[model samples]
Target: MLKKDSLLKGTIILAAAALVVRFLGLFQRIPLDYMLGSIGQAAFNSANTIYLLLLTIATGGIPLSISKMISTRYALGRPDEAKRIYQAALMFGAVTGLLLATAMFVLAPVYERLSRVPDSAVSLQAIAPALLLFPIIAMMRGYFQGRQIMAAGGISQIMEQILRLIGGIGLAFIVLGLGWGDKYGAAAVAFGSVLGSIGAFSVMMWFARKLKKQDRDEESAIATDKAAKPSSKLPFRTIYREIFRTSIAAVVTAMTVQFVYFFDQSFFMRLTSVFYNHDTAIKVLAEYTNRAMGIAGIPPILAIALGASIIPVISSAYALKNMEEVQRQSSLVMRIVFFTGVPVALLLTVASYSVTGLLFKSPSGYDTVALLTAGAIFQITMMISNSILYGLNKPKQPMYHTFIGLGLKVVCSLALAPFLGVYGLIIGSSICFIVITLLNVRTINKEINLNILGNKWFAYLAAIAVPALAGWGTEYLVLNLTDAWANKVSYFIAAAVTSVIVGGLYLIMLAALRVITPEDVRSFPGPLRKVLTLVLKPFYKRAA
Candidate 1:
């Protein structure tokens, strides 16, 4: 029903690139955390998250909608239509990006007050320029994806993240060396986003040139038929209408992950003000944003990659009305995300103390880190399922579900933050994701009679429970055993050792439980499959 190995290969490429960027972010935080301290890191995160929320709003829906629409057209043998759609998307992206960038720059002070993080307004203003370029880059990436081309996008992502990291680190060092306070240092780091966007734009423009050449070649080949048809006269207004129809729902669905964080960013301080003093509220929100949000955010990168990759594939299938194929891909992706996401989340939660200690000089946010990381499982599932819903052409389901879940999140956080502090916000987020994930899966099942977990729900719970208990035990033992501790080098050894032992044990249990069976392993792309086979050899063998 589907092309050979496209989904596997595309997902693996995107996943690998996303993995590098995500982990690089952790390593990037090390020096930054030292330079900024918790308060400064808070400033960094406050500006970063505010910038990201607007970035999502500007680029999120357009790119995804392009991918979906273009893929649907191509599946119907309308390559000319697909090309026209991309052109329209490009113009739209440029205009939208300029507007959003201007809005961000003009409203930086408003965001600073809302987030209640001191020294954030300058950083927010500094990061706005990045918004001007990235929307175009994102749309181009989506076009490549619509064409089922993955390399250009993946390479450009690496380029963007690498330059961003280098620029941020370099600028922050210069600011701090000049004896500027954290205020300017944070702004300097935030300005690096503009540098990163330029790098990404360069890579994307190069790819765009090649893509245009290919498009011309395609046009010449099809000039006698498709391109000459009356259908090719489709108007610009129709393009805008179609894009907006999908994009409005798409934007809300895309915000599912960040919407909760935006709530915390905007209201956490204001809500908890009566219960805690200004300094105390700021400290708690800082830890919540910097440490908790940082560690918790890692594993979901894979899900996001897989989710995005699924769009074109799912759109093609949905275009054909092949619900069975949609069902197959949906079930496979859900299991893959959960099976992969659970262990990593549990490890981070169990090892949050060591991880935070390694990254931060004075680690005081381990509890928040643990809470957030523990929630990543649900976060990962919710994301993949959201993608699945989008593929089903039920784009509005995730949008509505996100708002409903946010309502609950807002209520739970407000009602409890007074009593429980940061944990209240985190617990509220966890509940939100869990509810949304379940709702999404239920909707998918209703639409396609999807298979979710089947008889393996307990198997999954055991897979989660066993590794968590063991990893927690191992962490406690190591922390208690190591008195020569708290230094970065010492924490590094503890983290490395714990990761190896826990990771090995977790894989063994997964194999023994048959969480990933031989049939499932075969669906993986060749390189990943080979590596996984070798890793799982002692516990489970692969078919030759």
Candidate 2:
């Protein structure tokens, strides 16, 4: 039902929105880290991790399921069936979200006790209601995505992040000023999540209503006289059955990353408590997971944005049995993943201390941050590959791989964290992601000749190394030259200069190495591609 140009345009809109949301998320965490301190942050992280896990279970798979099912039916010219499926998904989301929210509220205290974070139940309870609302928002977004109209979903996401930023930061200040304890302050911050969800749900509902009106207007314009046949509408029970069947695999595959984090939340403190006091362990984790990895999480958003756009695009392509288009999209997606992911990961590694200090006001845990940043290369790969598998209708493959990866994460975390502390956790995560990425890539290769990690891979490696090495040299020189100028402000300035130098050089390297071709730039959003065209004209000429 979606034209090619519209699909590409929608993907670009969503990807751009995703980038903005990631930036807003980073801004939100800055104030949160400053206000909550280590122990308070540890408590918030504990509750938030559980909240994320439950949220994933309640809302994650259903959207993908809705998108896939609706895309398929719509491609077959079955608008009535697609609409019926949307209705079923909405009802399902409402019931499921309510049950999950109630369950989360009831179990909040138990989770706090298990994690040994004091007063975390307050935050957990505060975030529960959002679970009931997010499912509805996700379902509506899925409907729009199924229609390949991604701007609605994109704008709704931006609205959520903007509101959450304002509400969380403001509430944190108010709570602290009012002499509330850190727990209540954390809870107030958690309440911002609820507020943000409400905003998102409202925006999505508006879009859904507009879409409905458009559909009705179009139907009226056509002026069909025949009464709609009952047979045209799918049976509700049958739709539900199919949805559940697809949703099982989708839920498991989608929850892979969240489940890894959930495992850490469940066991990290207990394991660290073995080596140190409970409070001390939580403090250390606050630095490692909460702060360091928090910044490290940004690069993967590029992959996540691409993956979200890829699922429906690839699904529709595969649905039509258009192998050529499928292959073309798959190749483009993988190239973008590697070309962007590698340099960003390496840049973070090279400037970990500077960036971490600038962002979190502390230069500690650079090694942990570097290791995690390195691991994100594989994380990005795994994310995009899994989406490709899901798009190709092989969702169970990713589910099985996720199980293997989860098992590895638990085993490695328990085995390593006891001895090496936070570093152990970092190592375990890296190994888990690497193994998962390999497995997913292997399966994808068998399905289609992706030619991934061949030929141009060495060029990708060179492109990553040159700028990263130069950036590191520049930072070392600057730091050594200005040894007396060592403060957060200084680090911030150094980071800004180094980022511009590193980023500019990396782009040049990509141009020189032909890792980013003119054809590739053409695939980008119109404005971005045009800017790149002007900047890289010589490189295009050289490649030609």
Candidate 3:
């Protein structure tokens, strides 16, 4: 059995690995935007949206349940049974993945027709082969995660992304430079997913070998204990039933948010195409959507990493009947997410043009991208809270919240798109997020028996908002003083520096007002505090 401390250490390592992967995503998008341009990006993003939806159906909730079941079984000293369960899951995943892939591949033309995207059929065709490969990859990822060897899974993610980053951009540029149309460029990018999946699978295979050796050693120990009692086998039927029972709920809960997004995209595509010419509107909407989504994508990656780590820790706390720890950690996670997200939303709102120019050099997407970036703050808050609810084993609550939000999004998209276009769609989505987040917060408080909306919540809101306004103000002053910087890199640097300065001022003011306790600061990991102290040392000394 793994000690609590050991599990915590593993979680930290996994979080670090996730952070690296997130950073890679940020950098990868830079090159992708450059190579794909706005139109190419639209095709790639559309393909990805479809791919993720399929992936959710293929492996989504099953992996989480697999991990939980395997970990619990292993903790109870049932290693052989756990291994058998892993093998069964692998087989199930393979069959499901292939069937889904085949169906999607065959229906690619149908989707293209429905989306009314003339050249996107080719891109969909190119992405078809990956469906066959990704299931096997996802199964291996789940197997490792079940064994609590999260590092291996994390490494596989990094390897997959690295390959995608290099292969997607490199191939797209080469194809486009060689006179290929945007369809070919999009196809080239789709092909990269296949290579990346293969690379990830290869790395996972090596990790599996190491696991095999460990299992061998474990088997020997089990043999020695066999004489003391007759070993019981969990029948394959029972195992399969158990796996499905646990996995389905997880899958639905995990995929709820993605499913909502997919539905929104499908609606957006159809609505926009209907209101405008097929080619002209699709092209414009695609660019607008990608730019908005690209800016919004950054913060979620971080939230996912943090939230994934938080889940198991929160789960273990619940398992151990440690309600205090559960409440503390949940609140802390919310506060941290709020602190990070609010300032980012404000910065993006204030400097949307600067950010868009710096990141993608596409001035056309500024308005919608700004709206989307602001929406991201609420989106991430909802995500974090929902994950916490999942960790608490109230998966259905999240589903309810998501359904409500999705309804709002669909209604707003349909009602607003005819007149408001992308901006209206964005506003509708943001409003939905805000509503969902508030509802989830209320549900979580009731479930956990904690007051989540008291002084702490109010203080964190003030802390974030005050600093965000200061940052916005500083940005305005700097831009006016320096003639808007003009250069992308220079503007990015100035905006980033200004945000930091303003955030610092906010933190100091909060500290002085005793909004956050010193113990709260002390609760952070030593290294994190050390870095914070280093950043704030000069100011502290001057105050002294």
Minimum summed lDDT over a 10-residue window in model 3 is located at 1-10
**Candidate 2 per-residue lDDT over residues 1-544, each given as its tens digit:** 3222376677778888889988887777777777887767776777777877877887777776788788889899788899899988889889888998999899999988887777878888988898898888888888887887788888899999888889877988899999987888888877888889989988888877777888888778885645654436678899989878878887887787778777776777777766767767767777765766577778898897789778888889989989888888888788777766777887888888888777875777677788888888888888899999988989889889888988898899999888887777778877888887888889887867785445777887787888888888887776666667757767776777778878888888888887777778898656657878898897668767
Candidate 2 residue runs with Cα over 4 Å from true position: 1-5, 71-83, 214-222, 226-234, 311-329, 453-463, 504-544
Q: Candidate 2 at residue 36, lDDT?
A: 84
lDDT of 1 by residue, 273-335 (tens): 878898888777777876677788788887877886887688789899888888888877776
Model 1 CA deviation exceeding 4 Å by range: 1-9, 68-84, 213-233, 311-328, 448-453, 508-544
Model 2 error, position 382 (Å): 0.4
> Could you tell me which residue pairs clash in candidate 2?
none
Assess the local accuracy of residue 343 in candidate 3 as a C-alpha lDDT between 0 and 100.
63
Candidate 2, residue 403: how far the Cα is off, in Å: 1.0
> TM-score ranking from best to worst?
2, 3, 1
All candidates: TM-score? 0.88, 0.89, 0.88
The C-alpha RMSD of each candidate to the native structure, in angstroms, is 4.0, 3.4, 3.4
lDDT of 1: 0.80
Q: What is the C-alpha lDDT of each candidate?
A: 0.80, 0.80, 0.71
Clashing pairs in 3: 61-251
Count clashing residue pairs in model 3. 1
| Deviation in Å, model 2, residue 5 alpha carbon | 9.1
RMSD of 1: 4.0
Ten-residue segment with the worst summed lDDT in candidate 1?
A: 1-10
